[model samples]
Target: MERIAVSALRKTFTLKPGQTVTVDGVTSDRIAVLDGVDLTIDSGEFITVVGPSGSGKSVLLDVIAGLTEATSGVARIDGIEVSKPQTRTAYVFQQYALFPWRTALQNVEYALEVRGVATAERRDKARHFLHLFGLKGFEDRFPSQLSGGMQQRVAIARALSTDPQVLLMDEPFAALDAQTRDILQSELLRIWEQIKTTVVFVTHSIDEAIYLADRVVVMTARPASIKEIVAIDLPRPRDLDIRNSAAFNAYRGRVWESLRDEVGKAQRDWALASSYAN
Candidate 1:
């Protein structure tokens, strides 16, 4: 059942000879963002990761996506080690990353085109996903012509159009207003329910993590490792209404408890580094 596996993962970024960073008043020549991290994700699972800023949540996603290689250990999908971008995975970054020149439909079709899907079929597939994401009538619009939320929706549609077995998202809604984020969250759940694709989403919002994740992966401070894996037993096909429920609050409380110390440490480290910089 494990579709993704990461074992004893360690990544160290060695600075140039003269480069140094001070953390907690200690100067360091190397930065360890992920150290001894081990995790397993099942197929068709929706997993969300939450940690303080700079806790390497994004790095973990990058490693799995094969955008960054580990200094040690390995990450694998379906038992194959991840070394480079693979067809089975699609990544949606914080930025829309849509080609400004490409219309919504064209943007969606681009992935299919790269995979060698024929013109007519890719167009049909792109149109269908855009429609499903509530951008049916706006497929002709360019990314510049659309609202921030609309552009992100197009990005999501494009990612899904490829029918990837694994979807990796890095704070995909971090820049959006609350109302837009709420809308997209529900829409994403709708799409996920229909298609049941495996998703690994990284976010800092506890509320968003609880709402979207079937299980939440909490990571430690820099040199990240799994701190906790909390499972949500809530019924599926969820909506925003669940946000107000006692069970929801309970989950939020639990996750926050695990996260508070990490956040404090990160803030302290930042303050220390700032003082050193000054």
Candidate 2:
């Protein structure tokens, strides 16, 4: 079933006078970051979005999450137009975004607390998710006491504790070391298999995008639109070793090929804008 739908979506930002920004090969008083973008994400689907910097990949996620409104078109969740944050949706960003004073368990319970869940029930749910994310013994530790990976794990645990119908992640693991990132990737896949929640993850890494997605959505440069949607046919229960497989490499190449020109274009646009600023 189509759990989320975006149709002819357009988002424009009006720049202050003398604040010049270039988008879609044009420099103007207003810029359209997302232009006529359309996409449909099914229930329980894992979709990864990839594109060059400033290509509105994050904007698309924001629109779908109801953090930003479209200047035109609409984004719908379960057939209802999304104008504000949906109760059944959860968002996890690159930052841990956990309270420094809160313990791991308390951080996870925050979401449930906001929803008015009973104190005892919320505590149990938080503990279950934290343990599932491998933070079992660290439950009492504050964010400052944990490593970067542990912090992110707690963030993910908190997001999942709500048992969200849709999970919107914006490079949630981007800050971790390569090794830690790999470990969390495997762990995430394992957890996803059991809960099967709909996920829309945005990342800059082609490998990460391909590895985590059922289909990878590649967007064009500024005035971003869907350039391509690459289906990942690789088997699930995927391990880190699969990255070394020939098929995985092939998929990587295809995604990079589609993204290469857009990246170049984005860079060129940035350079041009800088020159003009000077």
Candidate 3:
């Protein structure tokens, strides 16, 4: 179990090289992406974040992962400020960044290798994770030889093999088909139950958020900030059959109600900007 606290988190991005603006003789070429996010996640919680595309959901995850510096405020993991990438955290991205040359087993073993785990122990750990993720027979398969879902599973196994206290996932199933996405979502929950590791997952689907999370964090349009936090009161060991339940639809509706205006605003903003450009 690991605790996470993001206090007044802010992030701004510089658009271009030497593109400066003057404000009281201060020149800058920056725009705010995330703004003043404040949230706390308890240990072993399954949390999902939802927002419009480009609303800084991924940026927020990166900040918490210690891969990106905040422009203001703080992100802490277990009370320690995240200033840089730490061994206590692992990230799984949508792209499934696996080593093309390495087999699934080898790729999972790589994380342990970097942590200085001995070859035998790491191999055993990697095999266990691969088996847990239901990739038992495909251990030697390369990334190209496996399906997109399998590759992402390997990526997840790689992350979990390190036994990190916190796992940060940025839409890891976004690339898969509808069926694959549904299956992976179930697999993820199963793994979460077994591992009991704190997880911060970002997704665009309202149903997915409500289904997978104990609490869903909804962000406003960019410059993003926490617009609302919705707690899921559903029971554990949930199955896909619950998606058709009235309670499930109610959760989905609640999240959508909170997110509708923000998503519309984001769309309008993009349209306005495009109109200006054209």
Candidate 4:
């Protein structure tokens, strides 16, 4: 079953008067981030998106999350148009975004609270997820007291507390140290296997993209569109050591090969735009 569908999706940002940007030596008052993107995501499938900097990968996620609107197309969840955030969808952003005053348990409970879950039930649910994320002892620790990795765990726990059918994560681990990132990656896969929510995760790291995806969606540079959708053939219960396996490297190489040109083009465009700004 298709849980999310995007068709002819184009997101444009029109600058206010006197504002402009240079792209490939051309100046424009409007920027097209997503251009005619078409995709179908199956229920409970994990999809990872990768692209060059400024390729609108995050924008695509925002559109699907209904945090942003498309300029000329449609994004749908369960065949219903996505014009606003859906109750069945949850988003985890790159930033931990945990309320500073809230304890880890409180942060996780916030989602359920918003939905009006009874206090006793929400508390139990939050504790369960916190334990699942290995934050049992730290449940009362405020975001200020937790380590970066632990903070992120709370963020992920909060997103999942709602039992959302679709989870949209935009580089949720990007800010962590590499070792922490790797740990969280494995932890995420472990939890995901048990819950099986449909996921759309955006990442700049090719390795992370491949490690977490059922399919990797590579987007072109600015004015982004699908470059290729590469299916991951690796077996499940994947360990971090799989990163060294020849099969894993083969998948990485394929994704990089498709993405290399786009990376170069995005860089060149950035250079050109920078020169124009000078």
Predicted structure with the largest TM-score when compared to the true one: 4
Candidate 2 CA-lDDT value? 0.93
* Candidate 4 TM-score to native: 0.97
1-278: candidate 3 lDDT, tens digit per residue: 44999999999998788665443466679878898999999999999999998899999999998889999999999899999998989999999999999999999999999989999999999999999999999999999999999999999999999888999999999999999999999999998998899999999988889889999999999989999999999988999888999999999999999999999999987786677566
TM per candidate comes to 0.97, 0.96, 0.95, 0.97
The RMSD (Cα, Å) of candidate 4 is 1.1
**Model 2: lowest-lDDT 10 consecutive positions:** 19-28
Predicted structure 3: lDDT: 0.92
Steric clash pairs (candidate 2): none
Runs in model 3 with CA error above 4 Å? 18-28
Native-referenced Cα lDDT, model 4: 0.94
Clashing pairs in 3: none
The CA lDDT at 1 in model 2 is 92
Supply candidate 4's per-residue lDDT for 112.
Answer: 96
Model 4 spans > 4 angstroms off: 23-26
Which scores higher on lDDT, 3 or 4? Answer: 4
lDDT of 4 at 22: 73
Q: Against the true structure, what is every candidate's RMSD?
A: 1.2, 1.5, 2.5, 1.1
Alpha-carbon lDDT, every model: 0.93, 0.93, 0.92, 0.94
